[model samples]
Target: MAARILAAALSLALAAMPARVAAALDMAGVFDSTGPEITISWEYLETPGRKAEMQAVIDGFAAMVDNEFLPRDPHAGIEIVMTDDAAHFASYMRRNYPAIDIPKYGVFVSDGRLVTYSRSGVGTVTSLLLPGLLRDGYDDLPQWAVTGLRTYFEKFYGFWETDAAAGQRVVRFAHGYHNPWRLQDIRLLLPDLKLANLVSDTPTVDGTRYQSQQRLLMIFIWKEGKLPAFMAALRARDRKMYPTYLEAVFGQPLEALQPRFRAFQETILAHWNLVMRTPPSQVYADRATFEAMTASVWR
Candidate 1:
């Protein structure tokens, strides 16, 4: 009788066990542990070269995010779903609403689901947003910070030239200098900017251009002769810092900096036209290509 009762109890306990765990178990509050694993559905995944290229992009984004933002306050195990089409992008965002917002630059999402759509041949983290601001974890970062970060990335990591003598980097337009942006630019504002915003928006005011330019200006102020003084001012974040730093760094006031900036711009344009005769490669179809090309260029 005792053995029978024990056996019945064991059977009942076994019956209570679930056949499968919940499919949506929250992991670290950012990801759904039970949801499908994050994937990079690149068409080129079958090709060894393409697969590696896609993997590098994933790795780059992870590095960029980790270096730029997440270290301060890592949430849950966030997963990134990389898609190449508008249909997939829309589906991903819709399925992951409240956790996402498409901004003027790119899709800004929380620990929930997020997707980066890059039709551009070369997908780079610098082109998306500055790693610094992302690292800083500023969801509502000022316009200056956004532009500053963009400029910083282009100056350092982009397939462009930076000249201390010229002081400004010439940004080649996708259509022309006047045209808004090319496929590369799209990566800069994916998942966030609506089609209308992309069409109408111009680099004006304290917008993208200003922020970008400010980065160069900041670099000029700090790295050049006025660095020590500029650092002191920056630490304070004082309104007067701009003027004092500007004077110390450039030996000119804010009003005087524009013409100098223009001069630098002209020098850059002339130099860009002279040296960059060939258009840079649009897509790094695989990692080897990117590695081969950038191996010498990037450290």
Candidate 2:
């Protein structure tokens, strides 16, 4: 009876304990680096070089995502759990996510934890994570926005390269235009790309076709210098006055802006790669060199 009473009391105490305290109690010795954006705890007993490499991976990921795609402090300090122990990773993931099946790497959306295996290639990790985070961040925004933030994100990130020479490792990051996403069939989808329909609560040529169509809307608002306010309205979920917000964002009547939006979209679609998609080489290499190589894109 005493043992049962003590166990019950301890359970109550732990249940009432703060989450940070419970986490520390659970893994007192293995806590690792804490960053402004993310805290990392790892279960790797590897060489110092390998350890540093994993930390670099974590840091690079944080840098890529440290933007408005997610609101500031969305999860109140999200955490990364890195491990080389495949068996333990599998067991813990199974326990935490019973019904849903995730691959070797995943984020616990509500619990504020993301798990990654150290040996997994960097490209794999970054590609998978961006969309998940983008989807989550954009969730609070109006659904009509499709939050096109993910398309904007892909234009700058999702490419990784590594090179080492003369006792130094040089890591290179590169990004290009959006993937094909049925650009060939875009002609078939073009007729349905009216501005009003794109922004309405309906599927516009399936999800893939929405990227460039929605991107045009974002750029139009961005050019009008009201993109931030427009996003704020969406993020605040201010649907009651969103029509007013839209009028303000466009700074013109809907009929007037619709044709302007379409023309802008058409001009860019003429040469999608050259017009809008800035390649990574254009970002880092000298302008003259990139122009000679990729023709007119400035790095």
Candidate 3:
């Protein structure tokens, strides 16, 4: 009888509260732990090879961080708080972490805590590694460099589904810079994206374009194969050094690189156009070809 009364009182409080504030505290089991088993989805268990594939990706990423990128431990390791509720996560982030760029569906890291909203399947694997690399000296790393490196490693987010064929499982992953994103159609927005505008202190104030713009620049950086050199050289960095870094790292003025940049985008846009024209079956018919074409841009 007391429990029923308590529940009723809580409901009344929730009804009276503002929508945003109410949503922020709406909790349905938040697991605040950092363990491999914690993130294993039910879909992985039901699929035969999915567990192994996902684990391999996870293990490989951890190894790279341990051996190559960050040899020492972060002074304070990350405390991950994951929840299934997207509105709860968004509201909490907005209230508590106003300065951080709250991804509509991905993980966001701040202040030794890695928070994720599982409504979109934990976002891409690339972003999950942020807490690992974000340590003592990294906060000063420019936002463009940070976003670019993270988005550059991001390939796709794949999930298994029942195929039309008998006893078949098909994998469909959004394979692009905008995987698991709210904004997928950049056709109308791309025309106005310029490197000169991008290389400024802040790439964009618009939430929709900020990630995309940083990603666009990073693809060029990776294709140039100077990612390490680029990141390293920029340690002597400044907010205004982005254009200078591009010129120094690419061995050309920003003006010269613009055409080359446009050429690369043209290739990507051409591929996108062709895929739009083709039927779904034809578009995904050659997984190898599609994956190759997507990764080819980075190479």
Candidate 4:
């Protein structure tokens, strides 16, 4: 009888203790009240502000190309992992993708994983990232795809034009201006653009030079012609018959369009274009001093 009483008393004491105090707590879930609606897991560790800035860039990009493609669907939201250290980044990549060649700076992936090397050949590779996203090219993209995407981005993302005398033009950076290129109407200045007769991504074309040409052509289209219709046509695959598409678009054959495109090219050359200037330097915030410098620049 005494043993029974003692057991009952102990049981009551245990039952009376608060659940939280009595049980092992899962601290990780404390702040994670909601389940994963859209899971984003990254290897990169960032401060609150930097993380927020990255999120904003993601949001802006989503807004730019959302539902533009067929099926009228929102892009499957992505996970952007940022690494604080190169060692960690490399470890993550090695663990996740063993076969990929590491990228030069950072990689962009749509359907496939992008491995960015801290360096690529002799130069820092940044253009590779932007075009990767724009074209959704996983591992490989043709020269045309690269050039075409570059052209598309320059046009959609408007810049500050520094106009000088004697028909010189310079593009200044615009703050938070999305979709610089206006691709709606391509008629007002058709003759010169037609003269250039620019076709992006042809066989035997110099890719780097072609990309530069494509950017200029896009600018000319926005300034002189109906850009949106052209974009629509291109997107719809109606442009497979290139000359016919041109004729239908401008009510003229390629011969008529050639002279105009050439003239347009001349005018474009007259401007002090920096669309394809020197490549950008790789940005690393690993060092405290470098981080401070970057912060100051942003400030």
lDDT of each residue in 7-115, candidate 4, tens digit only: 1111111111111111101111111111111223445553444443333323322322222211112333334444544576677777887887655354434342333
Query: What TM-score would each prediction reach against the true structure?
Result: 0.40, 0.55, 0.50, 0.50
lDDT for each candidate structure: 0.33, 0.43, 0.44, 0.35
**TM-score top scorer:** 2
lDDT of 1 by residue, 1-299 (tens): 11111111111111111121111000111111221223334321143454334333333233333322233233333333444444655665667564645433323334443344444222133434343334443444334434443443332212222223334321111101111122233333322332122112354334443443445444333334454454344334443643343444455555555555545444434454332332343423333553454434311
Arranged by TM-score with the best first, the candidates are 2, 4, 3, 1
- Where model 1 places Cα greater than 4 Å from the true spot, the runs are 1-77, 94-108, 118-145, 151-263, 272-299
RMSD of 1: 18.1
- What is the per-residue lDDT of model 3 for residues 1-299, given as tens digits with 9 covering 90 to 100? 11111111112111111111111011111111122321233211133554344333333233333432333332333333544456666776777688876775445654544555334332242444542354345776656666766554444333333334323433333423433232244555544456676767855555646766677677667666666567656554632444467677877777777887877767656566443432121123335666655553332
Instruction: Please report the TM-score between candidate 4 and the true structure.
Output: 0.50
Q: Which stretches of candidate 2 lie over 4 Å from their true place?
A: 1-37, 43-71, 83-100, 104-110, 117-140, 158-179, 182-187, 210-212, 219-226, 235-246, 273-299
Ten consecutive residues with minimal summed lDDT in candidate 1? 23-32
Q: RMSD of each candidate?
A: 18.1, 12.8, 14.0, 19.6
